[model samples]
Target: MNVRVMNAAVAKTVAPDKPAAAAPAHIAATGLAVDFPLEGRKQRVLNDINIAVPKGSFVSLIGPSGCGKSTLLKVMAGLVTPSEGTMTVAGLSPQEAVNARLIGLVFQEATLLPWKNAIENAAFLLMTADETIKKSEAFDRAAAMLKLVGLDGAEKKSPSQLSGGMRQRVAIARALALDPEVLLMDEPFGALDAITREEMSECLLDIWERTNKTIVLVTHSIDEAVFLSREVHVMGTGPARIIETLPITVPHPRTEESYSDPAFTAAENRLRSLLIESHKKGRR
Candidate 1:
């Protein structure tokens, strides 16, 4: 659907006089800034930021550890309110979308209940998000989501019984069970080993392609960003702001060989240089 229709569906708080062409972006921020009060001084974290994520797009925010990448993701998820500026998810306020159950979130840690098995953990989210779903139906839905994330045979396993990658898969399955229109992830695979990280990236790409959900991922891995995202929103440090939105032109259905392609290499190199510069600026 076009931006106009999307905006209408979400119903923005923007001025009615604003033309439809100037409607709120699928996910956007206008002069967005954020600060935290520390020691009687406002410590800014995000500065004069502006962004627009189109519908059904896969986007990544990449930067150094202190560069506010996670903060930006939090703002989008409505977990942390921005100190200034207006932001929207699908035209509605972040909290509005969140309350509407139109957005799902995944984080670095799986954050599963140790006592609950995989199916229970996944089904719990479905029931929590929508109380109308019956217990049996919730389990059925969760089972399907577990299968989608490639955790088919491990449905009855508790958190301790699963591998790190499998735990993350369960987290992803829980998020997907909500059937959200958008998924916001913050370093969801950051804790995994290198081999598992790469594997998860491929698995996530397959899911994104199949679900067509608007996704915003915050990660420190340039290779992961280039491989999985249609565009990478690189951020600068010291009250972080977006430095560039680099488009990844490499073909989709990306495989292990895709990493060696010149396009992917070039994109990775470009992001690396930009991040290096951002780090240097932070040190200055």
Candidate 2:
């Protein structure tokens, strides 16, 4: 796979003379910003952020800690309200989208219930979200989702019985059980070991391919972003804003061998350089 890095500015300015009609964006933000009160003063976190994620595509937001990458994701997930501008998920307001069950979110922690088994934890949301759904039906649906995430035989296992990676798989299964149109993940694999992280990356790619759900991941690892994203959006702090978007053109169904490919190396280097620059800018 030969990765081609496209500068966001150049791509925007050098559009096709007669651009073809494009599909509506699954998630979009215009002039998005967020502010928190600090010492009775407003502290801006995100500023003038704009983004469009094509339906069914995989994208990533990567930056230094506290760069508001996760905050941006939360905005898309309807967890946080922006102080300025607007955001839409699946062509509706973030809150509307959430009400419609069009968005699913997974965080760094698996947050599985200790007493419940895998199937029960996976079915918990479905049961709680809609009381009309019968327990048997929810469990069946959750079982299918667990199987989708490669946890077929672990339905009865408790959270303590599962490894970190397996727990995350259940977490992902729980999210997917909703059959959401978009999935927002914030460092879902950050706590795993190096090898497990790589494995989880492959697993996530498989899930994305199978489900074809639009995914926006927030990650601190450049390699992880390069491996999993169709485009890597880099953010700069000091009132965080997206500074660049790098399209990772590496071919899909990426395997372990893809990591050693020149294209992967190139994309990783490009992201690393951008982050280094952002870091320097943040410190100044």
- Predicted structure with the largest lDDT when compared to the true one: 2
Error of 1 at 150 (Å): 0.3
Tens-digit lDDT track for model 1 on 123-161? 877898788889999898899999999999999999999
On TM-score, the candidate that comes out on top is: 2
Question: Backbone clashes in each candidate structure, one number apiece?
Answer: 0, 0
- Whole-model Cα lDDT of every candidate shown, in order: 0.86, 0.87
Report the Cα lDDT for candidate 2.
Answer: 0.87
Question: RMSD of each candidate?
Answer: 7.5, 4.2
Candidate 2 regions with alpha-carbon error over 4 angstroms: 1-21
The TM-score between candidate 2 and the true structure equals 0.93
Per-residue CA lDDT of model 2 for 1-284, tens digit only, reads 01123443354221211111266678888888999899999999999888888898898999998899999999998999999999999889999998888888899999999999999999988787788998999899999999999999999999999999999999999999888899999999999999999989999999999999999999999889989988888888887887777778788779888898788998888778778977887889
Q: Worst ten-residue run, lDDT, model 2? A: 12-21
